[model samples]
Target: MTPGTRIEHDAFGPVEVPAERYWGAQTQRALAVFTIGTEYFPPCLLHAFGLQKMAAARANLRCGALDAERADAIERAAAELSRGRFDADFPLTIWQTGSGTQTNMNANEVVANRANELLGQPRGGKSPVHPNDHVNASQSSNDSFPTVMHIAATLEIQQRLLPALAVLRDSLADRTQAFRGVVKIARTHLMDAVPMTVDQAFDAFTRQVDLGMERVAGTLPRLRVLPQGGTAAGTGLNAPPGFDTAFCEELSRLTATAFVPNPSKFEGMGVHDALVEASGALNTLASSLIKMANDLRLLGSGPRCGLGELRIPDDGLTSSIMPGKRNPTIAEVLVQAGLQVMGNHVTVTMANASGNFELNVAKPLLIHNLLQSIRVLADAVRVFALRLVAGLELNHERLAANVENALLAVTVLNPVLGYDRVAAIVREALASNRGPREAAVSLGLISAEDYDRHVDAAAMAAPHGLSALRQEPSGTSGRG
Candidate 1:
């Protein structure tokens, strides 16, 4: 009777469950344990569960396991749940209870109970619509849980993560174009090695991100294979002959995403290799993101103390004690997010290895952690693109000054003055604490006008000169 108190169920017969156990007692226990500091629940998983229920109800209707009226009632309830209703009912504490049976039961009970209420029946009444008998009929926790996971993961990758990555990739490409005419010293092993355009650096970042997104995209087709008809042990013992294909087809139609019946129901139901593969792709993308974010942070480190190629926007106070100090907080957040995704990959890996032949007990944690990675990556990409990448300002004056001081500037004059003589000039410039222009003038190896014409930073930074150098014959002398 009381909100948080358990009430007796008549169908399962006199079983007293907590009133707050709307999703059942197991879910209530989980809600208390995995109480991490996340503000929002993973929408992808929620949407997947709702979509699965709708698909399953349709399948049951077609099979005559559920009446048309009840099927319609379940569909309406599922739609409402997908639209953000009954979220509180899906709450579960985050702890490994040997398997994800608790979580699956939570979805079953919530959807079933809600559907019953929508059909003008009492909370636990199964008269017109039964939760387990009709709604979850022909389904086991093993099949349903992983099916939902696969659905959720695929949708999230296609709809959320991929789009965010595209936005970030485009932003990086724009930076590459904008910096095409700006030359900077290319550092190898933290020492200047050659002259390169700032555009080249941004292009490298864009390429890694684009490749990472490709890897992520490549994993989606594999992720669409569902373990639905496998039932308990991948034998389809309880499920009808046509249930697997029909259910998958219905799911595909309902979610508007590809959902194929897995080739090996045993493997699909018992092992989580698909999840491991997907997580691996996410980890790869996250690593690329970390590298890019780190580079941006270092490049924009300080106006006076470090390589100040670009400046980040000041959003909030970076510290409590330091004034006028705006830190690369956005970059820092992106780094942290990438780290979280890597950790999630590790979790999925461990879970995948721990599974046995009949069922993987790690479904709940696997889905939870994988979904966490997807959400974090999607948000991080968006934030970095809009707040950090798009707003980045190049300090042209500083860039030019740094390029002028770099000894690698001798690279351009190597064509006119020869490598041996240019190498001598570079050494002299570094030793005398003077710029290459001043050193060249004092050394008398070059006229002031000749040096200016051959080694101007602006000229060297252009794509034409760089393209020519790239096209040059390796063994040939650098003469016009």
Candidate 2:
């Protein structure tokens, strides 16, 4: 079939597709039916598929299934695909295909046909370099799918997600230092409780993100172990004796990733615990992101009506009906993405648990959901930190006003005035609509200047203030 020539096909019913279309009739049909949504198969998984084909070709060569020339052809083709050569051919349409067989065949055919072209053979011609025998030797769809999934996830984490998380961590660190001098009223149950610096709040957020990144890093070692040797079942029945380790070694060398062989073939083929654990790590990160994003939203709530401790940038009009209204749209998107990632984690967990002895048939959905989660989280973390958290401004005046109205002022007055006196003054101040400083002065418990000097917001924002507060006896000197 030459360019601009239409060939009548039995399967496709004479509809004209592109002359260079690599996928077959079934994939084209599925593509037409599943075009209802914008959700397309991500490119990361395709790259992983290409890597898997390359590894399979190496495994075949080591196992004597193909000569060096044929292996070189398949490898060269796979490398081209991995370098993002044949992207347009891999149109995203496997969503409607139940078993993902269409996608598997699509990958096989594309790489094989390309290999044939490179070897100066006719397209789709099975010769010394056959798609199944040379390209897919010693592998089943069951093993190949999950292997590629692991490769995709590991690459995404290392190349994109972890780096984005590091950016977020550094942003929070900078904000922590920037807000170190600003004192704000801390809240519990949405009511004022204690005094803390904005730096402390940002530090807490940074800690959550740091711990989540650590957890993600911890899962990488386990995820690097692959089950390539388990051909169809847990038994390496068709695999050459030493092909397992050699193939893995070759893959590691080719991809520059630590691709190790699975120690126990049974567990590798039977379950997807590695993927489950990876998803769990992602779930941990999602949980942290939800908490941090929600806190940011609440802290930056309103300039006039809410806490107003921090100011987030207003990106757009929040409402169509209301005038001069802005909302935390970035935070909302981060929170929603976190929720979706959590749901994806749950789906992965259930799918992992439901796998039978020899295979986990839920890999298509698992890879789909997991990769989506990773991409959303990586992009969200980057956008949220750069656009919202990094650019946030502390509303120092509002914070001071809230602190003056808070009952926690008694905490500062308890050292100079006894605890009982401070408690009484707090009650009287609340009842008489007077500030704590005024109540202390009216009762002659402390001079107004002395009260101001002792409870200095700037001094109290320091780490030394927390140390001093910790040393003071509980009921004796609540003042630091």
Please report the candidate that would top lDDT against the real structure.
1
Q: Candidate 1 deviates by what RMSD?
A: 3.7
What are the models' TM-scores? 0.89, 0.87
Stretches of model 2 off by over 4 angstroms after superposition = 1-19, 24-40, 91-101, 316-318, 414-421, 443-454, 459-480
The weakest ten consecutive residues by lDDT in model 1 span 471-480
**Residue pairs whose backbone atoms clash in candidate 2:** none
Candidate 1 lDDT over 451-471, as tens digits, reads: 666666666655655425533
lDDT of each: 0.79, 0.77
The residue pairs found clashing in candidate 1 are: 5-19, 6-17, 6-18, 30-92, 30-93, 31-92, 31-93, 34-94
Clashes of 2: 0
Clashes of each: 8, 0
Q: Given candidate 1, what's the lDDT at residue 121? A: 69
